[model samples]
Target chain A: MTRLNTLLLLALAVTVPLSLLAGRVWIDPFDPALPNAAVIFAELRLPRAVLALLLGAGLGAAGATMQGYLRNPLADPGLFGIAPGAALGAVLSFWTGWAASGWALPLFALIGAAGAMALLGAIAGRGGGVLLFTLAGMMIASLAGALMSLAISLSPTPFAMSEIVTWLMGALVDRGWADVWIAAPLTLLGLAVLLRAGRSLDALTLGEVAARSLGIDPRRLQLLMIAGVGLTVGAGVAVAGIIGFVGLMVPHFVRPFTDRRPSSLIVPSALAGALLLLVADCLCRVLPLAGGELRLGIALSLLGAPFFLHLLLRLRRELA
Target chain B: MIKQSNPTPSVRVERSRETGARRVSTTLDTNGGLECAGVVLKARLADVTASLKPGEVTAICGPNGAGKSSLLAVLAGLLASDSGAVSLDGQPLNQLPAPKRAQAIGFLPQSAEVAWDISVETLAALGRLPWRTSAAEDAAAVQGALAALQLESLRDRPVSQLSGGERARALLARVLAGEPRWLLADEPLANLDLAHQLALLARLRELARRRGLGVVLVLHDLAQAMNHADRVLVLDLGAVVADGPPEMVLTADLISVVWGVPARWLGEPGARALLPG
Candidate 1:
């Protein structure tokens, strides 16, 4: 185990309890029997904290798998268009007046994500060319993005638009154990698939022909990636709306811990992602923002965009 | 340093003659030769036939589009031919599972596109994917390959950061670490320097002579092919123009016919040969 991976895991463990402590009401960890302190800690903090940790790990793993399978270092979970598809589904849940049905939005989002994944597989061909796959993902994202915009534009009520906007920005407020149950199993399954498919990713470093010659079927590798990303990112976006940058940035941060072996980077990236999102969620609770509470996704985007810009600059310089 | 100069050809192939000592239940290694009979790749092969005997180094040399690489790819199962069959020890090549086939044949493509900065040790260890060897066994094989290729000093460095010649040796070490029965490399000597190229050829020749590993390589240098390989298979426009000993196969007339250049072969027997046009 590298020092960075060890630190990331240590950070994950420490950040979990810290996230539980960062709500509007300062619930003391030492005191158990205060007025509604246990209620606030149990009913509110625990689920949100656990959900953030797991979803962040899923996104991180997804990012590592995408960059590896596509053979591009800058790749992320959202590159597959699953995130946008999930957003579109969640938006439809609002427009169709099904948002009131506890499970409709996330369920709709999962279906949309799965559909987009299938479309990507069909368009990219069974051979799994990086350019073709990226183009297919872009097309899927564009279609999903267009549909989301159409839904927002065609809304009959302004209140619905506002509600939709708030949901789309993403929040961890008032989430319960039920939300955790919805996303946990799927994310775990996805993470397992991605983690176990390391051999193919490692073989892929030698390029398609060499990887194939090494007994790795490119189609099988792509299928495993598609299924893995679909379940985790789909369930994640369905629950938390569009949490951007966790997938893209965590891999780069954890990459140094690994010897550039894509397989070994999975766990470290997962741990770092959990740490990042937990920190972000904690920041959302304590930061003195004017608008009651800050959105978790907005906080991630704020941290991610500049990091992304920096990476772009580095890439440009490397190319130059 | 250099394993040795041109080794005396010994017919002791790597396979153990003690039949009961075999570990695996598969018939993967029961037969000896890697044979391609009437193999027809759509645009690449038109019922081509060739065979590689155990513990013998064979070189296939030809022009750019002479299907040297395609032939190698077909042999390595990297390309599927429309017709004909490839058999290993008499069993069909495609019938065997990927791991079994990989166990029998190690392939080195012309260029392996590396996307990350991985250490040489990690790069070499990837060859053990086909077999689940014990940790000690894996370590020994990786170390042995590195030592054999004289890459132990560079083992800790990132393969992506190595010089072209160094990277080529590292990649070769990766394939050798697997200990496959046959090695099929496509123009592996192209990026290597003159000394390394000769050293590599020497090493391959020794591997065939001592370990009984069938070493097949694609080469552009006719003199090098004639000097190092026991036999030469010359391809021209996807057809085998010549197949025999170096003396019988690489004549001046054959060079003109295949490579489209008139060249004179100048050298004595059992000595370095040079092709000057």
Candidate 2:
């Protein structure tokens, strides 16, 4: 591991524990006859923190894979409409009051994401050009957004409509072990597949003919990477709704520290992704508010968008 | 255009600028070659049959769109032949596993487009990817290739920061790090200055002779091909129009027929040189 990797890993280890700590419902490290407190910590705070870490890592890795595979800095798995599709699925569950049903929302969300990708492929035809890519993404996001609104409008009352709308903005509040179980396996599998794309992607930078000559079959690699991105982003949106910029920004930040080799960046990007989200979630926990914690995605965007602008200005100044 | 009625083996080394400094020749052993039989590839590549032998550099020269790149792609197993067979050694090329094929054959396309602005060391190390799952051998291999291409000083420099010729050499070092038995390059001399082009060709020739490596290069510059290649394979309209020792194969008539410019040859005694009129 490089010095940066070691530092990132250390940061991640500290972040996760810090994330689990400082919640409103606090449990003493050791107290007689406080077994119920321990159960609450295990069943509630720990699962939420773990879910946030996994979701962040998944989105980050998937984003990195999409960017690397397409050779585009702006290609976000969420922007590709998978996250909107997932949000739509979760909205449908909420419309039908399926939020109370364990894991049903995530399950429906995964299907929605997969279906959106399939639909995107059918509409755009194997991602031919940058225009088609953006067009397909817009179409899927619009359709999913429209459908989510439709689901809310069809709800029994204004309360249900508001519930689905808030959920759509993205959150990790009230999550449990069920959310963790639902997302973990698929996210890890997706990450593994994406990481495997490092070598093929490196070959691809040499161009199509060269990559093929280097013994990397681009067709096979593309199929595997796209599927991996879909699964990862799908699982993340299923649990955390639609956290933006973590995917798009984390890789950009981590890339400079890495060798800039697509594959080598995956692990570090994932770690940073996990840490970034942990900080955001932990901030949500630690901040005192009369109306409980702020929504996770809002906090992320609030922090991330400003940082993004700062980076852009710095980049421009450097270029200038 | 140079026409040689009789050519000598020692003339190959005598022609190069680095005549003596860059050689530790092996016994000139020759085997493990690629053979294409009646192969028809993408629309660009038609029925082409040729043999590339180890321990010698063969230049595939032709006018633009003469299937030079397509032929090399087919040989590298990047493209499947529509008809006929290409065998590495004796086994069918497609049947070879990708990792094994990568180890045996190194291919460099004309474009040196690396998406990331990575270090030269990291970029060169990519050529050793097939063998990377093993121990720390990749570092040594990367170093050896960088040194071989005379890019040791630029190893830590970012590829984006390197000059045009330096970037070209870095990409070449990537291919060399693979330690392939057969190295196929498409129009590698493009964008290089005269000095670097000649130096690269000389280095390739030395590697072929010393490492028992087979090299097939698609060259637009007929003059460079005629001077460097042991054998010249000329393609016209997707077929091998001429194939033999460079001295025997290259002539004003063939050059005029393929390139469509009337030319005459003036040869020197030191080495068979081409001077077009």
Index of the highest-DockQ prediction = 1
TM-score of each: 0.92, 0.86
lDDT of each prediction vs. the true structure? 0.83, 0.79
Residue-wise lDDT of candidate 1 within A50-165, one digit each (tens)? 98888989999999888888888888888889899989988988998898899888888888888898888888686666677888898899899999999999986898899899
Which residue pairs in candidate 1 collide? B13-B212, B14-B211, B14-B212, B31-B89
Candidate 2 lDDT (Cα, 0 to 1): 0.79
- Residue pairs clashing, model 2: none
Q: Which candidate is the best by lDDT?
A: 1
Q: Give fnat for candidate 1.
A: 0.72
Model 1 DockQ vs. reference? 0.58
What's the lDDT for candidate 1?
A: 0.83
Docking class of 1: medium
Show model 2 residue runs off by greater than 4 Å.
A24-40, A96-100, A117-157, A288-292, A309-320, B1-32, B267-277
